[model samples]
Target: MNQKQSISYVISSQSSSQQKNYRTKLTAVLNCTRLLLMQELSSRGHDESKESLNKENLIELLNWYVARRKKINEVLFSNAPRNDQMTSPSIHKDLVHCCAVETTRSMINEMGDSLFSILVNESRDNSIKEQMTVVLRFVDKSGHVKERLLGIFHIADTCAQSLKDAIDAMFPTHGLSIFGLRGQGYDEVSNMSGYHSEILERLNIEELSGRTGQF
Candidate 1:
């Protein structure tokens, strides 16, 4: 039977609660997958906006997929009622947060006790607030080098000390330690490069003191 006929049959055969449950699960999966894809694209320098991934667009994409693939249509739409879609904005936000957490966890796991270097840079946003962005570079278990965007932090100022302090405060939250940092890099702009040298000196002093039991 065609997809529409199959869906009609399933709707008639399935109970309302069953249809709702199927749709809820399917929506959650599709939303999480889409959010992850969008994040990957964004990281690769693709510009994306919420309107591009809005609920209506997602629903249309799902419908198109169902129309093309017999197996996917049978599995996803078989018990899902046409009107029982779950596309709340709040749910989408929650899914996006979940994807972020999962991606960080996976990155950390792949890092696996390896020493990583950090590349740091600062920029002001549209609001004129300075923010520092850090990216971690390391070799995974398979011996391939990888770089992941660790985080972006709002800073009180872009001074060397303030930037160093911000990174010091951030590492522990993710179970990372300055001791694991083998190297650091910063933007080649004169002020930023100065910050890089000062921060490296500070980190070296701290590492020495920690090992030697001296303040």
Candidate 2:
């Protein structure tokens, strides 16, 4: 007839072994307000029956899982800062500040007995306009050699004065001073390496005078 009547009929007609299975237990839960069959299944150590919930409890559990799933979906699709995210350009100020601090520290480390050697080279572009690239090479406090490109400036003339002014401007901008210079060198070109160029001499004198506050 109905689920309750069927469970009752099975329990009365079938052997106890058949009655103990979920078939009967499920029928009883769907039909009977009293859960006597469920309790018997529990006493028998039927794990499925033991873990089973009543209608109200099952509905409550389903609601909880539904709410939990909604929350998880929201979190997954939401715009939030995730792990391993890179800093954007909006925060580049912090990155630039750190670079400045490192530059200052590097200059401080080059303070004592560090050789500041200038290597100047000239190259012409497609327009045949010559440009000078100055490289500052020195040993840091850790005894490891370091070098950096000072600048690459278009030179109106390869004369010592123009190259010197461009090179000199770059030093102070980086919090560096030429007084640390201990050596001078240049490419094979006469304007930089040759005595006739006089650029190297001016650099040496400029550096020396800087040491004594002459400039």
Model 2 weakest 10-residue run by lDDT: 41-50
Best by lDDT: 1
Best by TM-score: 1
Instruction: Provide backbone clash counts, one per model.
Output: 0, 0
lDDT scores of the candidates, listed in order? 0.67, 0.53
What does the lDDT read for residue 90 in candidate 2?
A: 31
Candidate 2 structure lDDT: 0.53
User: In candidate 2, what are the lDDT values of residues 1-215, reduced to their tens digit?
Assistant: 47656857756786765434334333322322123223433211123232455434322332343365643223221222352111222332343445445655665556545657777787888899979887778887777887766556798877767777777776777666666665666666666654576765666665475454422
Off by over 4 Å in 1: 1-56, 63-85, 126-128, 189-197, 201-205, 209-215
Kindly list the per-residue Cα lDDT of model 1 for residues 81-161, writing each as its tens digit: 445434345545566667777878888888989988888899999999999998999998889999999878999988877
Q: How many clashes does the backbone of model 1 have?
A: 0
